[model samples]
Target chain A: MRTLVGNHGWATIAAPGNTGNVADFLVCRLIGSIFICFSAILSGCHAPLSANNSSRVEITYWRTLTGAAGEGQEELVRRFNNSQNEIHVHCEFQGSYSDLAAKLFTAAAAGAGPDVTQLGTFEILQFARAGLLVDLKPYFAGPEAINTKDWPGTISTAGEVEDGLYWLPFNVTVPVLYYNEDAFNAAGLLGPPTTWDDFYLYARKLTVRDDNGVVREAGVALWNITWPLISAIWSEGGKLTTRDYGHITLDDPVVLKVMTEFQTLVREGAALLPDEASGGHRAAFKNGRAAMILDSPAAFQEIFAQAIGFTPMVAAYPAGKNGKVYAPGGGGLVLWAKNPATNRAAAWRFLRFMLSAESLAYYSQQTGYAAFTESAQQVMTNDLKDSRFGVIHDGLRFVRGDFSINMSPSVRNAFDEAFQKIMVDLADVKTTLMEADAKAEHAIAERGI
Target chain B: MTRTSLKACGIRRRPRCIASQWRSNRSEWLTFGAFVAPNLVLFVTFTYWPIVYSLHLSFLEWDLIEPSAVWAGLGNYARILNNPQVWRVASNTLIYAASVVIVAQFLAFFLALLLNLKLRGQTIFRTLAFTPYIATTAAAALVWVLLLDSKLGPFSFIFARLGVEGPQWLARSGLALVAIILVGIWREIAFATVFFVAGLQGLPPECYEAAALDGATRRTMLWRLTVPLMSPVIFFLNVSGFIAAIKMFDIVAIMTKGGPVYPASSTYVYHLYKLAFRDFEAGAASAFAVLFLMVILVATIAQFRAGQKWVHYE
Candidate 1:
């Protein structure tokens, strides 16, 4: 008369009348295992215990910063906590950018998301559209609002969605060209390449090959992601998407020219894409396998650390046919709508504290990111004395952020795939762009954008 | 007057007996509920509810952030079908799954046969063979990528020594899929070998002795006697291996990322992931999941039916 199916399922069912058998033992073990699993899950789901002094407002802040940047964020929180008795902020590092986004979305669905999060600038629009973000307009109108005049227009405006600011630009990154000064000296070059034509000439002159025609040292390496590629496109006077964000303009001939120039480097063995196994393209440059690399200025400290034998030089992105536009890159802090009213206000207070002049200066100095506010710039210039930060801050005016769209993730993926096809598979450039353009259009339409 | 009194007493006593029985039944039911409640609650909360909710989601248009889902009926399904990428991913998945099953089973059986022999360090060999199965997939993929790297990898150096140029394993289109498949096989063969070893030990020695008396060669014995006797294990491996292959994600994600172009190495799960998380099309992803579930279900049932014909049991 046993009603339960044991560990072996049908075997336990068939031996129903046997009261003391192996099936009974197995059934007990199975139940024990299930309970163990349940305990583990429950333990994971337990909320972080609060400090019991309940008068102070408590709010959770999740961020994707890691390494030195992560430590800087923790320092900021420590400073803010020390400065105030009204709010208690709990800062947690939540892995990488994509990892944080997934957690945030899942938490938002359960209405247990953090009071604040640092997300990519483009994501502000997507989250705002989904109503997961607080508009912050009311805060702007309030007395304690963040000063818009102190912030860089590039940083401030990039966080806007439909005229409503959804995020406060915290740390900013602008793409820059990092070159080996020793390699340039050996190659008899005076300075870093300033234009596309100069880039090709330097790349050819700096490239060195072995007896087997294997490239011993490549002139440059381009990251496979969209930022470097977009920088190249904009430098060539091409736009990925039109002004209204309604359609893509990648199929234009200017983009074709940019693609061809990039491909020629790989084809001629002067430059290459990052090999997935050997870390990244920047790794090659740091290890002296490549003469130059294009990467974010935020990587300045890391590249310098790994540059061991050579002096790492930071310069503006190599200009192309039309002008010297760089890619605007960085993440920003956004308040979550899932937070309680008091916690949301606390989060707002924390954001302002993080963006203050001294705080921004400390953050930028520690993390190698650019200071976004005028006051922050003055502090960096006077206190930090890092001239490289000033160069990046000036480059911000000429850069444009990745086109803001609610469906930007899909668009970015489409472009990544197309870039891979051209660089790795050696597919026809024009055909791949056409295909990617169509694919992005379809994604946008399907997303109801 | 005495008979009437006795009948009334009997009727009252019967009613009391019935009430006592009801109370005993209630206590028994309570005990049963207490025993089953932990599992029942967990099953409904995690497993059963999510399945039912996901099914409901397949018919609606909802991004997880949206307050309410819009009724889309069969629109999500239509979009999945209309998009040409689904078919491409499906075809790649089929190739990957079939190849993994065939290659992994062959390698596992051969290794198990070798390990079954009377050799020194037998335990060490078995442990070494089973290690990769228990290893973290992300770490293993990273190691594999390093091993296959062209410029600085040992494999490339070995190839160069042999006067052969190594292909860019993660860069080239056709080779990238091959690289992923090789890693997939590496991860699976260990598990299959462990199962095969156990199955080989379970075979009765009498059969082998009888086959030897009949003057059968070792090869003949393995083919005629061992394989048929081990058919059930082989069949189990085939079925489970195919399911694992179809659901493969981490290795591809960590290694190739469905890359080098469209229709190259993207699997069904990877495509569905892009839809759900990256694109925020939960409805379409749900529809895709429903289709994926049906596929695995049908394939599993078919394998069982096919097993009945070919699988041998004593």
Candidate 2:
């Protein structure tokens, strides 16, 4: 067409004679046609481009993870930001576990909260019930909001309420018995105690006292049980709460039996009150003060810290007399102070980053929180799995649901209070629990919890 | 010419003085407001704002996470004021405070007098005595804990050698409170001792010489002459000691942590700490804090009124 225009230009110049010189005319036509055609195509593509636009979204995530895992968490965030072009996340480490909860709550009330937080298991239920979380359905759209296929059952199942999913376990672990091998061998014990009866008898055999009447080494602590005391009740076929969420089933016969047995251990001085000198049970086991101690598998780092002194043996959460096994442990990630727009978005982004396989493995090795996802546990970059924490992934298998997770903290605080009294006051187990049950019931009613 | 100028200056002096007085009256207003504004602003910000906020919060049922605090009139206060734990904690606070102040001050004052006698290693002893106060509470508490250990600590070893069994300092229910109190007193009395030493040194030598001429012994001089003259410093110590003791938190947290089987170790501040900070029960904790403030106010005013008898201002 350009060449034809050029050929005709000489005739048309003024006589409608062909336009201009042939080469010059061809150049103008070619340039004009090319610009017009491409401009039309660009205009037509605008709608779809706008529909599939990629704009940066930010999420401000607050976490309580400190110590070693804190380092890995920052790495995960950095990688996540680098991996995605459309989103950037900023994660801040607020102090310890309890400190972050308080800060998040205060920020929430002030309407200045972060988008996400790594909350402890017990704290999640309380905060979630306060209507402080974004329903995953809105952000994620369905029950498969997060890919739940690789997640352990108890870890994910507990968070799905009738309306929405409240929490997700990014890093999860269950408590397991850790024994100092050197101490066990010295005591002539064949292996770590597997059952309560065996544990009690082994505890007595391990007991040793200095001439001063103060215990040189306690076998186990009856008084201190952050999780196992509750686990003990669950193990003996007792439930912490009823289906109605009102009854204190602590008065059940099986729970009483365990309590009585625990009391007997206390009376015999086989178990002891955790002393400051012992630096808690973890330290107790490390220092040879106690041969056996029970705590979260998250404590594997501390076990690692004690690598010079003792070799820790991690076993399954022991099964009880009724053959009912319970892991009175669980943990999950929560979005805190994420009450509003910008912070919440950023928090969600960072949370998603933590859920990714690489990020989870990176964080798992840093903190002792075992990966609830199979992808994470299989390939840890930290080379620490051969230590005590490697058992954490399998240990999460024992976690069972008890609705007591939703009980108000007043009840939990009261139970701890009552438990301490029953332990130190030397009260009869049935009589003490009956009183505690009554007290707890009254407290629940009084608060209408 | 000089006589006339002097007469003129005398006549000018009266009217000029009156004029300057009016000018200075405007400056007085400026000076007064300038002096008070800074303090008033700080008080309104840090003190009044928090109190007002907490008072409003006392009516709410909101946790820390909620966007808005839910109003729950009289509910939080009723829950707390009705509970017997409140009273127990209050009484425990009084006991903890009184025991710490009274026992610690007595020991500190006596030790200060002993150290002021120009002994061979008075400087070393003074530095060593106050060293505990300089240490972090957790570190000091940890050290004491290790020192008191029944199995490993030398204290128990010595006690055992003496044919007496030592108490479980932190583990036993009955002994836990005593153990923490001892820790508080030991760490705190060091500072008090140094202060007492300064006050003893400041006492007029004339009083001692007068007592000596009158045939009084050292004990007599301490009871009559020194005590009377040093009463002002002692009064200051007592007031400050009372305030510090009631605020006991670090000792209990580091050593006992409100435990050894009971909540009685939960002093007012510690309980308030656990609720407001730990449990996120802001409204309930605020009410408790306000009530505690009132109790402390009453005790303080009563102390000032009663001090006229025992405290010699002169």
Candidate 3:
């Protein structure tokens, strides 16, 4: 039998009196193969660079849009890539606004994240305060700088915090009223309601009941979110909070009055409050179960595309007592402050491309978000003339985001809970609002807001 | 003579005995170490390290975006305890957990007994019962949402036919929690049924034969022999079911998002997630996590201690 023996550091099969040449050969070959494999892996790990693009700066951009909007964003990046070979941007679609914010925060804490990301209006102040955002004002001074005069004043200044412009408007949207024209014609309404009283009366008229008294079609479907409701509250001469968020006034008498009217509509079976599981109010309107809905223009494409057998029309939100004061809704671009100087410059260049008139117009037309720039509106002149698109853009001039208390998640949660209790549970409006105010104050103090 | 006597008497032979033992068991010890090393390393890295770090974080205030944290000590715990929402959320969690566990186990045990009977299409029944446990929870939840719609759902059609308005299962606060509990029971019954069936099949026939020979009734045999023999499975199902129900997050996240009002149907993990991610309060979330861990630990220990009375080892 052959015995195994150790010589120096090698194990070998030892014959009676022979040197283990085969074992040595096998061991040497194994080590050689491992070395070659490791070398190949290391060499293959380098980023693929083409001959002409060796000097191009690579940067990452995280956006929070999907479907047609996502495709529009991708097309813009593609055009920018083809326009010049100086930079290459890798655009990634992060999930919804809240999801993106959560990931961005954790990533920023680790000193690593995308070079640029889309930020919601509510998140701008928080991020800027935390020093995670780069001030865009510094980048707005060069030859390629954006001309703020062309952008709507409210949209342009929405990201201003502590005198620094940390976010640049990209996909801006304003809430608009979508009504089923067929239902409106059947209800014998001459035109869209111009006042809240007309809106209430119109809802009652449009509501269709069967012989059994079950509502076959609701008159209006209220979106169960707080965004569109903000416009209603503001139009009624009610403020959610002060400009500085020093005090929350959700319990204001005017706010209660507006909410009570809404509650009355629901109680009267003229309005539908569809839950998210039921496809929200949008689906209710699309399926001919509801005649009208208040939603952002961002929902226009999908609503029109899916509202079969009904002529979905766009109209301005019904004016409240103080006339319409709309709240701007949508997201903007924010550069990460921790990016290297070279990457930051490349990211800014990409962001500038994204905000160009041509790109903005293309995105707005594709996604139903309003083109916030004059040049972009000029680009879409024909489209803007259409009644459906015209009504959506009309609210741009009246948009306001001064009520920033909704920026606090705590306060927002309180408002949402209070709204749900009033609408769904039919709780006492005054008591619920009072409780929400107390909750918001407690949260504000606890968070040192 | 003295040295030899001492060595043979086990006084001076202790070192040699240990050496011999080590030498003989060296390969066995190495094999055991090799087998356990990977799991140990993984547990330390993913579980232990995070738990220890969370404990450290609970003592400090951090928003998770800032570079440094402020020392808050027990302030987070104190604030969490004082927050009324915490009590509301805790009550919701307790209600959900207790309802899911007791109802699910009761139904699952009966299902297991029914399925264990020698009926036609037994294989098909088993597969049907187990399908929900294997379905992707998020996808299943979305489908459930559509099925529970107040106006357009099948239930609404059925209710309309009966001349009654369908209850808004997911819109009303109280009914929303009930709907969640029903879904939890539906999902959990599959898991518990499969285990119970297996345990039933594994039970010894000798005990039942002995019971019959002793002139015991079928009911007596079932209650005494079968149940006693199946106590371990029952114990396991209750313990695991309670833990899973308490930690439920995905269903609530997809179905209601703790809605219709704050803390209406929120569970512990869902509330903890909102605190950490939504509110950006890492310290308070960590404190919440620590408290949650303690509650789960105490509950599990209590279950185990009570189980010792009835759980039989074969």
Evaluated with lDDT, which candidate comes out highest? 3
Instruction: Please provide, for model 2 over A261-361, each residue's C-alpha lDDT reduced to its tens digit, 9 standing for 90 to 100.
Output: 77787788877656644476666676776777777767777776774466767765566765545553535666653444644555566677678777777
Specify the CAPRI tier of model 1: acceptable
Residue B200's lDDT in candidate 1: 97
**C-alpha lDDT of all candidate models, in order:** 0.80, 0.70, 0.84
Q: lDDT, candidate 3, residue A270?
A: 95
In candidate 1 the C-alpha lDDT for residue B194 amounts to: 98
Q: Candidate 2: deviation at residue B176, Å?
A: 1.4
Give lDDT tens digits, candidate 1, residues B76-149: 99988987889989988998898888999899999999999989999999999999998999999999988988
DockQ for every model comes to 0.25, 0.16, 0.37
Reference-based TM-score of each model: 0.88, 0.83, 0.91
Q: RMSD in angstroms, candidate 1? A: 7.5
Q: For residue B66, what is the lDDT in candidate 3?
A: 70
Cα error of candidate 3 at position A145, Å: 1.4
lDDT of 2 at A372: 67
* Model 1 per-residue lDDT tens digits across residues A1-449: 35554443655444635544444454566567777987888887664437556688888889987878899999999999999788888998888787788788788888878888898754666788878898888998898887878665455667667767787777788788899999999999999988888988899999988767767789998786767778777888887875345877667788777887777888888887765555778778888889999888678778877786999888877787778776677678899997677677788899889889989889888888888678988887764455566667777777664444323755666677777778777778899888888887886776634
Q: In every candidate, what fraction of the native interface contacts is reproduced?
A: 0.42, 0.42, 0.45
TM-score of 1: 0.88
Please give the range of 10 consecutive residues that has the lowest summed lDDT in model 3 chain A: A11-20
Which parts of model 1 have CA positions greater than 4 angstroms off?
A1-49, A275-277, A382-387, A405-407, B1-25, B162-165
